[model samples]
Target: MNLQRRAVRQNVEKSRFELPVDGEVALADYVLRDGVMLFTHTETPPALQGRGIASALIEGALLSARQQGLKVRASCSFVVDYLARHPEFADLQG
Candidate 1:
């Protein structure tokens, strides 16, 4: 793989993803909106949680938002908290 974070071409190819421990496994997070990326959700493989996989996915999502020039309504609590901790990305969050 070319290590893409914008690979939304397939249902499995995601807008938000994490490749933990240098790509040992991949997990996905997604944002769904009627007309925008209003909420973010994540599913890390059970073994991955203690490894910061969720944070990785959330961070990738925020970076993707900045790259796409999109704003987040932050329906996900994790996203809300992530925004709170990373004020530099606050401009992308609602």
Candidate 2:
């Protein structure tokens, strides 16, 4: 339940995806596209839910976006809510 940033990787095992907070019970992600990214999924393993891992995943994604110079398109509700509360990330919001 401690929200820690995890490594970022396009998981080869999953083949069709990338991961933020790798190895967390669950993960969240954004799909990069046309200089922007879509926050398409939010997942928290049953054991990790309600402990803010989803938020941490979102934060990891946002920081990754900043490092990549990309804007964010928050299709995921959790990420939209995160943006609402975190104005510092406003610059990266799409």
Candidate 3:
């Protein structure tokens, strides 16, 4: 069995949610306005594409937004796809 370490998500100066992975960072960029979070971009390093870091980043960001009671607008296609796959977050969309 192969066990993989989980990525820890962090907010960097309130601008982006980041997951550090092997000398790189996967990021979900967002802008908060009028009780909503506009997800602007999502990027993972090419070397870290298959590691699940992006999922962790999105999960964490969405969890944070939920905890804060902020709605989400998934402008980033990655986030849109993620939301479709994870219905638990669908209610958070604005």
Best by lDDT: 3
Candidate that beats the other on TM-score, 1 or 3, i.e. the better one: 3
TM per candidate: 0.64, 0.76, 0.85
Q: Write the per-residue lDDT of candidate 3 for residues 1-94, one digit (tens) a residue.
A: 0122235455758688877777998888999999999999999999989877788888888888888899999889999999999998888988
Clashing pairs in 3: none
**What TM-score quantifies how close candidate 2 is to the native fold?**
0.76
Pairs with steric clashes in candidate 1? none
Please identify which of the two predictions, 2 or 3, would achieve the higher TM-score against the true structure. 3
User: By summed lDDT, which 10 consecutive residues of candidate 3 come out lowest?
Assistant: 1-10
lDDT of 2 by residue, 1-94 (tens): 2236554344424421333343554566556679887877777777666767667667766787788798987777887899999999999977
